[model samples]
Target: MNLRRLKYFVKIVDIGSLTQAAEVLHIAQPALSQQVATLEGELDQQLLIRTKRGVTPTEAGKILYAHARAILRQCEQAQLAVVNAGQALNGQVSIGLAPGTAASSLTMPLLQTVREQLPEVLVYLHENSGSSLNDKVMHGQLDMAVLYDRAPTAGITSTMLLKEELYLIGAGDSPGHNVDLADVAQMNLFLPRDYSAVRKRVDEAFSLRRLSARIIGEIESISTLTAAVASGMGVTVLPESAARVLVSSTNAWMSRITSPTLNLPLSLNVSSRLPLSPSAQAVKNILLSLLSKPTIEDRELMLVG
Candidate 1:
C-alpha cells in the first residue's frame, strides 16, 4: 500500500530487471529487491515471474500494473498542478489540431486570446489528421483539440462550435455561381486524401447523387488547394470557414453546393475525466466565448437572407 513501493514495482516492471531498475533509481539492487518483496508481502501475491532473461508480470501483476500506472499518472499530474499553482499561469499546454481545417478556422484566434490573457502559458501546437488528433487527446498527450464530429472518444466531451457549409470553389466565376452535382461531375476536381473528413463527406454526397467526380489531383493543404483552384487546375469542395480566407485573399468565388450543401460541424473536445488546470480552464472559456460570437460575414449573410 506504500506509494513509494508501488513506484519501485512500476520501475522494475518497466525496466524488466531489478539491476536495471536499481541503476535507474540510483539504489542498490538488494534494496530494490527488498522494496519489491515488501510490496509483494503487502499485497499477498507474487507480482512478477523471474526468468533468466528478465522479469515478466503475472496476471495479477498485469492488473496491478494497469492500476499503478493510472495512479502514478494522477500523482504526477497533481504534483505538476501544485508546482504550477505557485507560478503565474506558467505551464506548458500541448494542443493537437486537425490539419488545414481547425488550424486556420479556430486555432489562430484561440492562440491570440491565450497570448493576451495568459501570457505565461506556453502553447505547443501539433497538426495532424482528425483520427490522430482524437487518439492523442484520448491518451492524455494533448490537452484539447478541435476536430470534426465523426470521431469522438468515450471519455471526451464535445461542444458544437459551428456548422461550416462546404463550398465548391473553382476558377473564373464558379461555373454559374451555384452548381449542382451534375455540373460538378463534368469538371475535374481536386480533393484531399481519404483520411480527411471533408473528403469522406464529398464522397458521400457524390454517391447520394449517383454521380462520379473526375478527380484530377489530391492535395493535403488548403493553401495548395486554393492555389490550384485559382490557377484553373480543378474545382474542390471545402468548408466555408476553411476556404473563406483563401478565397478572399485570392479573389476567388465560393458558392454553396446546391444538390446537397455539405455541412460539417466543428467540435471542441476535452477529456472529461482529467482535471483541467485554472489556466487551461480560462483559455477554454475564452474559446467558448469566441465560438459564440458571430463573424461579420455571418451577420451580414443572416441580414441579407
Candidate 2:
C-alpha cells in the first residue's frame, strides 16, 4: 500500500474539499483528484461522494478512514517514540460532551484538568445532546464523548461514570418533600419529548414497574422546562446537578423519587470504528483519575480509579 496516497486521501477527507486539500498539499487540482481516483480504483470501492459543497465519506469510506487514521496515528507515534523519547507529547483531540452532563459537573472541570496537565495537546470541545454526540462519534467526527445514555447507540462502546438518583424538581415555594414514584406518577409534569434519551430511560423505568406518570407537557428546551417547573406550571424529573443548572440558586427544589427509586446514569463513550489518539487517551486517563473526586454532584462516580 502507498502510504503517500493514504495520506492524501486522509487530507482530503479532513478538509472535505479536493481543491482545498490540493492547495494544502501544494499539488495541482487535477492531479489530486486523479490520485484519489487511482486510490479508489486500487481499492475497487467508492470511498468519497463528491457534492456541490464538498466531499463526504461513504460508509465504506468512513470505515477505511477510521482504520487509516489509526494506522497513521500509530506510525506517528512510532516516530515520536524514537524522536521525542523524553519530550512532552503533542497532538489534537476532538471530544464531545452531552448537554445535560456538562452542567457545572464535567465540562469546565474537564477542560481545566486537560489544560493544566496536558498543555501541549490541542483539544476541540463540542457540546451537544447525547443523540447528536453519538452520531458524530459513529461518523468518526469525534474521538470520544462524555454523555448520559445507559445504552449507547450502535458502533459505540461506553463505561459507566456515575449513577445518580432521579428527582422531581418543583418550585421551592411549594411543598418540598420526598415523593414516591406512585405519587410522582400522579403529579402534573412537564417531561421531555417522547423520543428524548432521558425520557426513554424514564419510560422504561416506569414500564418495568407497570407505573406511569401524568405527563402534561412535552418540553424540548431545558431552560423552558426549568422555568415552567419554577413557575409551578409542572414538575420535571432530572438529576440533581442538571436540575440545579436550570435553577441552582432559585426557588426550585430537588427531591428523589422513591418506591422504585429512579436513577440517571452517565457514561463515557467511544466509537468502535476509530482508535484513540494519544491525546484523547491522555484526556480519558485524566478524566478517569478526576472522576473520583467531588467533580460530580457530590456523588460517588463509579470510576476506574
Report, for every candidate in turn, its global Cα lDDT versus the true structure: 0.79, 0.77
* Model 2 local distance difference test score: 0.77
Clashing pairs in 1: none
Model 1 Cα lDDT, one tens digit per residue, 1-305 = 87788788888887899888999999999988888888888889999998999899999887787567556656867887788777777677777777656345667788888999889888888888887777666545677788777655676888777777788887785566677777888888899888888889888888998998799999987678878989987788888777777678786887778877678888888776665666667777877888788877879999999
Error of 1 at 268 (Å): 0.7
Model 2 has a clash total of: 1
Candidate 2 colliding pairs: 172-251
Among these predictions, the greatest lDDT belongs to 1
Off by over 4 Å in 2: 7-29, 49-57, 76-83, 102-104, 135-141, 152-157, 172-176, 182-189, 192-196, 209-224, 271-279, 295-305
Question: For candidate 2, lDDT tens digit of each residue in 81-140?
Answer: 677577786677888876566333656777888888889887788887788888777766
